[model samples]
Target: MPKRIMFTMGDIACAEGAISAGCRYFGGYPITPATEIAEWMARRMPEVGGAYVQYEDEIASITSVIGASWTGTKAMTATSGPGVSLMMEAVGLAVMTETPLVLVNIMRGGPSTGQPTRGQQGDVMQAKWGSHGDYQIIALTPASVQEMFDETIRAFNLSERYRVPVFLLADETVGHMRERLVIPDEKDIKLEYRKLPTVDPSEYLPFKPDDDLVPPMALLGTKYQFYATGLTHDERGYPSDKEEVQIELITRLNNKILKNADKIVEVEEFMLDDAEIAVIAYGTPSRSAKRAIKDVRQEGIRAGLLRLKTVWPFPERHVVDLATKVKQIIVAEQNLGQIYYMVKAAASPTPVHLMTKPAGMPQLPQEIVQMIREVHSS
Candidate 1:
């Protein structure tokens, strides 16, 4: 069989990927570096019998998605840093209700509306910690146009599989880049839908979980009179403020992702078998890290790369193991060390170093190479 490849922009690939993954509805307000995703969905969704609505604000945009998800439809939204800030409350709502949702944050520079057109990965921690209260989230970072398409599908699958909001945390660099992407046949795409209630709807408890800590979903118009709220809820989905109920609900939410971290998170290990130095990175910077790793190797440095495909759940075990094996680790990002402390904490005693560039553009391969040499010499 001949290999098939298509040339397209990353944002277009992402919107198409969502459609292919059965995303039937997308509700979002337009924002820079992310508006292309919304525009693509607007043009494409109707042809596929899906729905795309440009809401008045990011808050409503995300709220509408939560409502649509309850109808048993695969739904999503796209936004950047400021919009993500607007959606934080709804994000907490999704978590409290255990709603299966997907959000694409095409991150750009931001303290407050900073550099709308440029790329920056300042949201490295926000994607995981933005929502209030304690809960787990699945966030995938794509370093290339291909992974933007590929990981969007994976985001939907994992979102349904875990009944948590999954995120495709793409930076502006990858979101705007034009590249070749091999579109796989529909049959080749592995799709996982939300698990339905097996028993009669009368026997259903909306917040009740099966063995894996994931509750089966029943659509809104179904026979079940399903109820859910952002407030702390019981197994029956009615709001409960009891101390024990709070503990059980929150504990289960945290454990579902943490206990199953091995299954839910993925990281790439490149040329690290006998490497004395390791470079850890994700999102667009990982692209540069790959380049630096190759070039550093040419200069007789046994440097390896650990590219995070799944940024959340932290991949602590992988970092810890590599820490024990390597003499030093370099944490690189497009922001001023947002994820650097995470690496330092996880790679304790490995003397992790930080290389960060704030806004404007992604960290270049040459910049990373210089840092690698400095760390190697030190």
Candidate 2:
């Protein structure tokens, strides 16, 4: 296949990316900003020999994705804030089961149904803590329509490689924005599939992990008779009540991510070689910050931008390193300050300031430039 380039919106590009990544199953509910993802999947899945199901709600949507993944399908689901809220418990179930799946949260403003049409970064923290308990998650935040396409594919690959749920944390601003998207030839796009169990059915212990700490997933309808449940489980995937079982299970889940943070976390630094003030941002806000940094640079402010391409498993090392060299770090996002706290903690000893735009469009470039000047002067 040849490279295809076209203009498209972020949500639609994300759906196309999933299909390109070999996602054969999509189960999701329709919601503002993210509905295009499901709509695109519904129309395109049949053409590509895939399945698309619009569930009754987000809970059923996520539940169906988990079940489909167990069947050895590349399954995914997309929704906005309220829908994600409804799927929290099921999210926990996926984490506990170590299911490899993709979730696209096109974040809209919310504590409730705050603003369905508006975009916000309020869900940054929710993506990490919405589900109960201690488990690590892979989340990527895309700043533009092009990234929505590229990052969706990356999300699926990561989920499969790590045997964990991965999220594309987009927002209404990016999801609805139009831009040029380039689709590479299938042969050129890198893809990853979950490792399958090779042991005989009788010898199979479903959750038994390899040295990487990611277990070989057994297909649901296969000859394997391994059991799986939400309860704390051992290598055999059976529920366990013992303290050691809980510790072993939870610890491995955490270690799989913590141990590989360097490989999983990614960020983009712009014009920071000799920057005096560093601006850390992601998602829609990063777009504004980029333009703002350029504006400040023209004014001789020596500003730079640190854009997070992978939001969760927060890129602490990069932020900490930037903090040491820059005089001060300015954190910007669409939310009041969800990720700001993480940056402050990681970039401690060095001063960190925040520029927040709550439940609104991403802060404008002019506004951000003004903030840069304020931080630069003081």
Candidate 3:
């Protein structure tokens, strides 16, 4: 009710944040690193007059959340890489139907459950491309326990406002680590709900977009009687087979987010005012990069960090702007180099270098500082 402060793990904080954001339904399957989210939801949902259902598998869990959302409930699910694999088809379904929901991914070492107890950032690209199709989704990478609490609430608000699935991407390191979290008072927190249709049920068009290119959603069990499907549909929510209809529908789906990227993207810059070498990182690796930058700064290296809080709209504008001022950009991630290519593409001819770590390992700050030194000398 009032401001609550405590030391908590990221996963537990995520569950509490969802409750704070007014989420009333949670449907998920337990998996490594992310299981605590479901466990906490199971215990807390009933206490909050909400429902938590543990389905047979991740596919059912995702689909259940989709169904619960149509009933005018703020619904979400949590999973890891393997569970995400099973939810891809339904992810596409949520996209086609324009369902507003949240998907929290507490990533573990993977490629087939590579290391359940270990952490990794290997799911960066998967969050963007796990589901097939030309679609856009918002993904947030929280670097600390405090961020885990704060970003989960933001994820729900974005999903509701945009009518798209938002991903809260965290790895095992962040998910399991305990740290201080401050929960603001209820009245102080900002919340957003889906825009409901103003028109009568007889005149409702479920897929009709306003000027913002986002449709006003009508709830199930209401006077509004409309159809929805994974198939390409017209503004009236009826199935359409025309090529023009396909293009029109798909284009709007992608553009709603892409056109708004400037507003949705968030990046934090540290010591970049006159830096010659820049570092870009996100999630757990961003923590390491911050420390690395501080170490290099003490050694007379003009280095800074560009930490990504919103990973999906990819923050190309920031990267491009950084390239104009910095001599080189170094990308550090706990993967084979997924985001490195993205940085290289955005900062072309700006000499982007990468420092990578394999799964089950941390990107040490000392190693990152060494890389900065090498780039400074070269």
Q: What is the TM-score of each candidate against the true structure?
A: 0.98, 0.99, 0.99
**Runs of candidate 1 exceeding 4 Å displacement:** 1-4
lDDT of 2: 0.92
Q: Which stretches of candidate 2 lie over 4 Å from their true place?
A: none
- Which 10 successive residues of model 3 have the least lDDT summed? 356-365
**Candidate 1: 10-residue stretch with minimal lDDT:** 1-10
**Candidate 3: C-alpha lDDT:** 0.93
Q: lDDT by residue for model 2 over 1-378, one digit each (tens)?
A: 579998999999999999999999999988997999999999999999999998899999999999999999999999999999998888889989999999999999898998999999999899998999998999999988889989999999999999899989998899999999999999999999999988888999889889999999988888988777899999989898999999999999999988988989989999999999999999888988999999988899998999999988999999999998899999998988988999999999899998989966789999999999999999
Q: What is the C-alpha RMSD of each candidate to the true structure, in Å?
A: 1.4, 0.9, 0.8
| Model 1: per-residue Cα lDDT over 180-296, one tens digit each | 988888878889999989888778998898889999988898888877888898999998889999999999998888988999889999999989999999988898899998999
